[model samples]
Target chain A: MSAQDILVLAEVNQDAVADITFELLGGARELAGATGGQVVAVLLGHDVAKHAESLSAADRLIVIDDEQLADFSPAPYLAVLESLVGSEGPRAVLAGSTTIGLDVAPMLGAKLNAPVVNACQQVAVEGDLLKITAAICGGKVLAEVEVSASPAVLLILPGSFRPTEETGAATVESRPSPVELHRGAVTFEKMILPAPGDVDITQQDVLVAVGRGIQQEDNMKVAEELAAVLGGELAASRPIIDQGWLPTTRQVGKSGMIVKPKCFIALGVSGAPEHVEGMKDSELIIAVNTDPGAPIFDVADYGVVADLLDVAPALTEAIK
Target chain B: MNIAVVVRQVPDLVEPLEIDASGAALDVDEVEFLINETDDHALEQALLLKESGGGSITVVAIDFGQVDDVLYTAAAKGADRIVKIPYDDDDRPPRPAEAAAMIAEAVKDIDAELVLVGSSAHDELEGVLAPLLALKLELPYLGVIRGVKPGEGGSVTAFKEFPGAAMAQMNVKLPAVLGILAADQPPRYVPVSRIRAAMKSTEFEEKETAAAVPEPNVTVLRMHHPEPSGRAEMLTGSEDEVAARLAEILKEKGVVQ
Candidate 1:
């Protein structure tokens, strides 16, 4: 209660500060401002000090370098966070809603009896109260959560905020990484990748995703023409791919590949919870469907309530 | 060894949804309830563990939205036991932390050596339930786990989804909770007859410990229907007109050559 520290855990991967870590700092700084507190960034990794100079968003940087922490294991990481929260008694803890953050935040919340707000896309201060807006029902609805408890841990969604414009070699404090839990009950074995095919959808910046609304197999030519005119790759929802109209490689959804393209044209795609799970993160989601009540419109940045058959070729011709 | 899989019933997203008169809650009467999506994957993981290693799996569901049907489905998928925590949709835990509290109590009473839950549930949407439950049970937890296999000793090897479909192979100690994203395989489809047979033979134990459902620390003051931010410019009129407008916007965004 005394320190009132606003802490952000700076996560590193492949020897660099990940973008999400920077995004968290951007959030932490804004939160720190309203609370009249100091923003502290904690870097825990092997030789992670190199990243200390880049987290300019922090008022202070605490670097804990340990070879044992080269990989993320919940046991040791939780031990470190628990001990830190115990000592610092921060006002709020913010981390990226990433693989590592997801693993660590709730565990910390549980240990401290603090509440956790996950996947909050926005954080703001409303008259001395900290508030977060989070997606619910796969983005069909939004919930603005206000914590009843201080020192609440927030797992923030990435791409929600912009990073600090400038870099500062913040005042650095190096602490000997805790050796108390030299090893965790969990151990990392190896890393494996999903089977690769001729087309790597992950690299595509824009995708023309079709769904059952595309109707007959022959109708796909219109989608292909639209995709070609747009200079983007053609993909499909699970139903279309399930019908063998496209290879698994061109599928987009929870069971398929998770993609964050710069722009996604969901032509005739009915946004199911599973499908939205994968593509909701797109920068701009344009949903075109005949049903004005299509669930995709709930999260779409632009909506065209019309049949794809009428629009696809007309759009392709217009573009050409 | 006993593995406890936490299942929750939620408003089936495919069905129509209506906000109740209270504004803060959904109209449970109108909405169809189904087992939360992630929970299905979690049950699959537990069943996979049961097959690979000699163990019994106990499926636990907080009574709501076709709990018996989902529990029976789990039985047909080979869960050895089932437990239902009597809960009222009207008076259910308002937040994920509180929900985890009820689940943690049930897990302890069952004396489960391993816990599996969906990475995220529809109702909570916090993506924190598994970790919160793990903490409440004083167990190590992992999130967004794809595959799980019982390891040589008292540990389990898990495949975790990373950026770009990469996976990190990790071994966790037993008595841990895993937030499952996918299982070793799609949950086996249980035939309707098997589910019916499960209904006849499988017995459900009600946890009397959850009688005192605690009040939520967080409360929603009001509810809001999204006002289309006006940022989302709707395209209307004739097909050609809409298409022309879209093309103009695409060209401005440089999405088109």
Candidate 2:
């Protein structure tokens, strides 16, 4: 009814903002530019105002700060977001397709009876229609979807949108969450961290990953050496993790972490869709597999048909 | 406790999917199909919960014609009943909404205190079915559930894996739907004897197909292997020479300082 306001739902954990939040803001900026709309970032957390300036790119920043909202509970988070969406009637709501966003986006969409496009790679607004593209069937195909519903909720793939440092003197407003904080039906459990060195790979600019072709667990040192040379993190295919050669957090595939590094070098990795989809957004992909026909080459920017044992050490030495 | 599990026979993960000449759909003829890996996890969780709670387990699948053996395999894995919704030859590939609708309708009659589904289907529809099914069933849905326990008063509590070093426990009222993540647990192997007996003894009741599957609006324009960037120039001579040559290559590729 009113002028379309773009709502960007900010996902926070333990009083820290998620990286994808800024990425979604980048995308919202582009969408707002095209549609003549204002970007309004909705943040819910305890002391949320402390992080308001970081999101100054938004035309308007709405903060719902409550002590009960310190941790991420779907009841409080979803209720606040739902209330904001209802009151503002944003033309579209965008969120990062992370684990938190994935949980909250759909719930918000279902509550509003709106359609949601999840894990979209690209979005374009033409007049009133919004066209979103996402990798489908793993990374073998790309599907372009058009959403016609009003106040559409979209889960955008992280790293797909590059965050720009163009800050504006935007206004920030603090508001009370209309939703009451009911004792959640869910309880808080202990958090289990991934094994040491199995930290966030999505934030890294360069990644060196290994696959089953490396032959044995001990032999993974060659790939690790290469990663060290590149100043990058070590990642792996599913089989590597399944074999216990690498931790599950280092696994790069549909089930594991999805990374969009600046450069991704795969050693002895076949390009399975599950694995490829996770890294397809990497700016430059160099896959070194003995098998020339390995699927990894399908989407790789560069391919080398050679054994990783020879190629990996050589590359590492050369880089050194 | 009564648990319902939804499974689908999808193209084997190890085998590559081939696109048909039309480029519109996968060439199923070349690829072998199996129970989706995540779906297997869901079935295993259901069986585990059933064993723990002393309950019955019903496994439901939308048979898309090529994967009848997968449905029987579910029975071998410990499903008490299997319902197959036959695929309409004329209809398009079953979408998440359609499968969820069929599963919701079938489970309506069955008294299921909990419904479990694979977090994501291996096919194009990954992680879409469970949430859609939860909406259709009007049940609170939990995604990426790694562990489940029977809480007090006929309620189920699950530890869901969240991003960035976080885990959330959701206590759902009875008759809730859960989507099990693929990494939740390893699927148990069924003995050969059980497999053979399941193949012969499993009885499938087919449900009426829904309306003509809507034709997909978007179509793949073409499918082809990506063109290789360039050949790696082999470097020979001393390590110093090799390093120098490699640095030059990286500079040429704009990868180095």
Candidate 3:
């Protein structure tokens, strides 16, 4: 417990550590180098200590094992974090900007009176200042910021850093909950997994994704035709699925599936950062939209500034 | 049950955004403000909860952009009270922590059972308000909630989403903050006539709080548009010409017959 340590909060999924945990560990290692601090990983949950064997990227692993942490409840988690962050004044605390991070980071910042930078993509310590680049406005803009406060709480976006390849062992330290864990106002009931037996968009080589420009449910047929003609599966952005025009399994974005198809055909998609996070790794991307300034064009391999309604039918006919 | 819903306006992304002279913010004069999409969902969820569970909806907002019109629309959609905090600083709103503190001062006396805010806003994707405000109010917090149903014994069954489409049914007790991702139903469309009526009939409750501008924890060194990767080969010309070009490229990639 020292100021010369960088702390990382490891997120758990189905009793195992999530990939974002390792990504944060990797990011923490870089910051640790700049601050000349040891990388410490904080794991909280029941029986989660077994998963700590894979987190060797950190210099030390602190496991707060408790039955109350069997599932994520914000109050207990926040309480435990306040104790830890207060005891060990780390140079910075890093967490993934996912559900858990977004839920707890701000509260933790308020509790500790520390600065918190969200959607953080890059962190650099220049001279005596800690600088960060955060993606705001749905990835439409990037802002470079400097944090003048000590022990900054940084919520890092997933996929921003590569997972560490180092495989050394970490010093494991087991500790009990600092505060008495009580059943608070929040209780975790059960997990709801997406239904199976749908066309898995993640496995498909070619995907035709539609967005809000599809407009109505009836217009989905045009995108489906384009998908069929391309020998591909039909996927959609969040808006289409939110309208219940497609199953949740067919949705792509930060909250939905992360896909890497060989050929991605985006129709009328404005390409918000969340949606772009899913398909940016596709081998080739073709975007069709009426707006020439749509962010989709920035990531597309081929961009067509035209109405997708017209382009869809014409592409279906042209392919046939 | 008494519910407090927070709504704010963000820059409409339909048009391109320009950088300001300061190089650290957007050119707000050239931007148009629209009610954040998720905040609209938050308002809708509040309205739905009120409709089903029997409650009063109080819509609160920071005075920025054309928020008066948004408050009127909420009134037309069944909000019982409207509270507007007077703020006329730069176009950029307060940071989440300061904003949360400011809002906490306004709503702390309401003694509401639930505080619903959008999970994230287009202008500020961090979605920190709910949790920060929860910390201030000493309440539990949940974010990325898709649907919320009033549960037995002063709790609500919140359908909260994890990453990768996984969801969980959480029993969040009353006096909690929920960052709503979407409502069970789409936001209702109030007729223009109804809005005009609301404008004429509705009175706003003003809350005066000390707007001490704290030094920003995070100082923006620069703000700029994301640089295009330049990998995109824009297919220009008429729609037919682009479609033909796309087909040939798809064929070359061996992705189509």
Candidate 4:
């Protein structure tokens, strides 16, 4: 395949564009510059064309608007994406490593017979090979993968790329999806948006996270009080969320939100890689655990060896 | 509601891993092996599905070495049958594609409506198994599934966790494979009595490895602790002064103007 434009699958939800779409556009801009190619952002979903302004960083925006594409279905989305890639023949396909991208990336890679990389924190064009660095082994290790194949598919991790406010006059064009979506094989029942109270630690600057050490639901008040003092949000480890003390949205781990807060105060967190991977990018990591040998200390910039219940209140008082 | 769960015995996460002197493989002697934590969630989901739907559950353990003990543990947790793929000592490390192939083969004979595997393994291959298995099995696949509810008409609706306050629920056609998220459900602990009974009563039929184990193309050059990050560039002064200093630091760090 010839060296062509870099195709970015711009993700949109409920007529609003996802944040990662611009983050990917940032990376695609860099890649396109290196490859001497244009960045084409592929926008899908009904009424998604109106959000084309967000893709201003791209050189061109390709919109595929369809009523069936309103909701995210693997069959319809993949069908549209596969057709676009086939016809466009872009040098590489970039997407956010979000839920939709994770589901679609590998399948697209398999279909196109190209190499696919997921959760990549960084990407650079190194000569002919696309060098991608992704968190491997539960974020304990960063593996640099070299993809030599053309038309490669990549899923960039959320928050990995800094979406700069670089303005450009991107030309917008509309295209009809070639593949007809069949409702017989798979069907969508409804779209349930998470409640407003959902825990979104990724957007926070500081997070006071509780873990199994908090022990009981009532005891979580200590964490809340500390969070209030720190002006941060209250998050939890998987155990706390699994126990129903916290909603699944509040869980901070590999499967949960990958947070990069300015200050992350992990209370009673054991710092498993799954959890650590989510918070390793934090500017300041302070772990308070009773166990001195807890893995949280490995990544924490400052570690206080004391009971969370005791230390949390003291810290809260100090901050106040 | 027949369910098939894939459990892989991976190097325990707690243990420190060492790359061999050749830098080609991990030192097995230095690492302790346990069921991949994410796969345990898959098994738990399978058990819960079986219990709720009153269907048979089969747990398949795809390992490169001895794993009977792990199989017994899975059985105690509510696996009705276990399929063990016995690998010769000379066999190379199992690739994700090869493991997926073996799993697809094992499920070919069983009338399983859904196959659940971990979203990713802790050791060796990570996050590549379920998709590869889905491709091999020619079934629709979903990854990062936090919760799954068996739906009407041989469909399984899965709640997938997305980044940044987003979730997508998709109803996969029957006989699909789901890569379970670690944050899905807490793993269930089997009673000691049940474990003992499973250890004695459960028998695994060892099947020969079907696919040719692919050689690992990628190699880890060396393993070392990551260089420590973050130096405490503290600023001490009056509240306003401290804020000004912090902002200066942030500006220097390119965080703020």
Candidate 5:
């Protein structure tokens, strides 16, 4: 009930607590140290109490179980969060910069008349205010922002914070729904999964990834040849997947698979933040693009400022 | 059904961006502006819906960053009406909250059954506008929708994307807001002659509304391009030389052995 507390909105997927929720808990723990308040994790779902046992980084866990929250609909989630935030006033609320978090933050900001910051890569508490560095313009630029208002809603990008190693016994409280629930205008019908039986890029040891600069479908043969020479698989950025040159399963990005292969070779990939977040943790990274200023070079261990179209075939021939 | 689509003009990212003197934003004068990619998809979705279900699309935009060209192009692609909210401030682009407030003010009287906007933009990667606009109008919102089709009895079926490439088919009632990630088909390529014809015949309906900018909650302290971390060892040479070096490196790492 302390105003200095930092509140974390727990996100659940497939009836289990999501990894991003743990990331949020880790971030909240750090912010709570400065605010001098306990870290409070609010879990909202149907039959979610069992998931709270893993949120050890939080000092307190609050679970709200209700039938209205069985599936994530915007209206009911907003209603519950609004009432909870109003009653349990905290210095700031942290959520993932994810599909669900992006959908929820703005609505909650409007409902509470609070300021919302998104795409936060780093956050710190300065005296009574908060300082955040947000990655915007698709990771080409970074903006440092100051939150001068209390009760701010901050949406953190995934992979910005590591999960906390501290294992503490958090006191749990099961609370009832604070507001009446009704069927909203939006109804979730069913979940659709990606098609199976494709090469799982996440399980690969060596990956050759292409991007829009690969020219067209014809150029894909070059990358495939290189991957074959290396005995590896082929992956692509979002544009390649969107253009249907590669299937969604071969896409490596925020919306696709997060891969950490032993050897990652990126061709013609400009390395937008969304794409970089998926493969930045590879054991060894190599990138080749025509543009010298491509952001992919920032994370790549080796960079070649040349056309991947020329390098791919030549490298494949050399390897063969 | 009457649908309203919000089209925005953003800096073309193909060109390298130069940081402004203030170190807090882009140097707008040097960059070229184009219709945002997803917003173009939103316009295309609106057109597809009109063709299939017999509806009218009223394209709306704030008068910023060559938005007139986008409106004209929408008209060329079969938009029924063009609505422009008067915004002359060019020193900086409107924040998400302010833009959503202004858009809500402009579109409230149109009585549109559905409002479609791009799910995210390059400048504001957070994609907060659609939900903020929905809250301001007291309408239910669904963001990150890939494809949408008209459903039975004033409802639309939307395929909303989740993390890990999962999707959910959602049934949304009329008078809702959708943040479109992509439309069913790619945006049609309207020829130059069609745009010229639209320019001659299309009349923009100017809607003047007092800008109600909410109090600033977040203020930019600084902005800059990411400094190279020196992690990448630049291999500078001709194509053959670089390819030879890459082959050697791969062999050393046992990747191409």
Candidate 6:
């Protein structure tokens, strides 16, 4: 039963365990309950131990406080995790589907000769089996997959599982660095900040965000009229920003600005998790897309199945 | 130095996508296939590295719909060598793990010093391919990189994206993998005339790796629309009617008077 325990690598962003870490910890609790195993959190950072008290989802927390491991260089993190896996032999290793998770999960899986079930939106146990639900073809095709039985590594997408409010009285254990301090091959350089854009879309109460389905830059005028009529700010998904159709500040999603607008209307946005993460919390969401299977519709409070080309200007005229 | 870039072919999901009969996968027979918005960044990154540092660039992929066109396009963009694994188009398309194993087996013979791939492919949800491929190759991989440059002593410095417009720079040792979110710049545009010229002259090296294609550890049991079912109240009718319907809802929500 100890072999089946789950080890979670808590991710730290800006000196704190990220929201995704809390989300994954919540998922880990459910998984541990299914396997009758304990959940352990690996806390590695300059002052990461402070998070130990807040990580109530874990049955135990292993704190490896070291300044040398402060920055995210894959080699050192891998070294620590490999050593932990060696000693703990947990059957399942869970990581947040962040940059760190994408960087580390596969490498660790390769090192352990184990298979990885990546980007699981949902996890369920059918009898003794673990099924990871993932999406492909831009979230149109949903796949329910089973990882290797004995042990599996999973990268769970953010916003898929709700963070639980459960609490635990887990004791913390401090361990010395198992690997030498001579710094791994990868060395951290300075952090480069994004340029400040013209307008901050986060401050707006209502947002009208567009994606590739808008088809061309010229059509942006139609979306503009809608935004203007509704007195909402204009925002876009990444492609629009990448194509220079809009300023970076007006972009919404993981790599862009996160907006919790009171009312968000998504036009032609297919709702990739990255984009969804930014606007999913809008008090009211209305998504218009031609593709019924588009992932954006999954999260929308009100969904419209129609071509944006037909609907955009029409909605603007009606609103006027 | 030898460098390899993993090129992938995927359906332009932005266009209409249809599900297959068994509901197993996308209906490839009906949809148009193209290399959508990935890997070419890796190609550009490889070219940039080759230009500044000395290296031969190789493009690698498994046979998917229109992969030859993608490899040929890579050739047009300045890949020195192109290799593709010939596998069944009917068998379930290779998942990230299986693709990595197949690519690793084929790449073993090429002996690349560094491998660069797009940060994430649209088809490879949550960006799994590069890290998975790097693992099978047993190489250290850096993901979500915006920029990369050759460093002293066979190491490279890569800039990875952080939220709130922050970028982290790291000096990673060579024989490594880099997931290119953006190259030094967007992929250099190879003109249509040059690509057609490349198509005629290029020699694609295709290897039969059906046996090397490992069975997918993860099997897709079923596919269906997402639920919290019937949540959206569809507003249908003529344009005027639909607009009136939407406006009424907005008024109810207090977004407008």
Top DockQ model: 3
Q: lDDT per residue, candidate 3, A1-320, as tens digits?
A: 66767899999876667878989888888888887889999999998878888987789999999999989988889999999999988988898888888888877877787888888889888755789898887677888988777788898877788888887688999999988999888899999888787877899999999998887889889999998887899998877776668877888886789999999999999888778878999999999988777789988989988888999999998999
Classify candidate 1 by CAPRI docking class. Answer: acceptable
For each candidate in the order shown, give its overall lDDT on alpha carbons.
0.77, 0.72, 0.85, 0.73, 0.87, 0.78
Task: Please say which candidate is ahead in TM-score: 4 or 5.
Answer: 5
Pairs of residues clashing in candidate 6: A194-B165
* Pick by lDDT: 4 or 5, better one: 5
Docking class of 4: acceptable
List model 5 lDDT by residue over A1-320, tens digit each: 89899999999876677777888888898999998998999988888888878986789998999888888888888899999999999999999877788889878877888878888889899998899988877677888988867788998888778877777899999988999988899998999888788888999999999997897888899999999989899999876776667777888977778999989999999888779989999998999988887889999999998889888898888887
Question: Candidate 5 — which residues are off by over 4 angstroms?
Answer: A215-219, B125-127
> TM-scores of the models, in the given order?
0.83, 0.78, 0.96, 0.82, 0.96, 0.90
Q: Which window of ten consecutive residues has the lowest lDDT sum in model 1 chain A?
A: A135-144
**Candidates 2 and 5: which is better by DockQ?**
5
Positional deviation of A126 in candidate 4, in angstroms?
Answer: 2.1
Q: Give the least accurate 10-residue stretch of model 4 chain B, judged by summed lDDT.
A: B230-239
**Model 5 TM-score on chain A:** 0.95
Going through the candidates in order, their DockQ values are 0.45, 0.25, 0.70, 0.25, 0.69, 0.53
Per-residue C-alpha lDDT of model 6 across residues A167-209, encoded as one tens digit per residue = 8887688887777665766678887766665667888988999
Q: Ten consecutive residues with minimal summed lDDT in candidate 6 chain A?
A: A141-150
Candidate 6 chain B minimal-lDDT segment of 10 residues: B210-219
Residue pair clashes in candidate 3? none
lDDT of 1 by residue, A1-320 (tens): 33456899888765677777877788777877787788888888777777777886688887777777778887778888888777777888888777788888877876787777776778776654667777556455567667757777887766566777657556898887554767666788887765766577778888999997898789999999988877789988855764557765777865467888888999888675557757888888888987665668866888998889998889888988
Model 5: pairs clashing at backbone N, Cα or C within 3 Å: none
Interface RMSD of each: 4.5, 6.3, 1.8, 6.7, 1.8, 3.0
Judged by whole-model lDDT over C-alpha atoms, candidate 1 comes out at 0.77
- What is the number of residue pairs that collide in model 2? 2
Going through the candidates in the order shown, the clash numbers are 0, 2, 0, 0, 0, 1
Put down candidate 1 lDDT per residue, B176-207, tens digits, no spaces.
88898777766677899999999899999988
Q: What is the lDDT of candidate 5?
A: 0.87
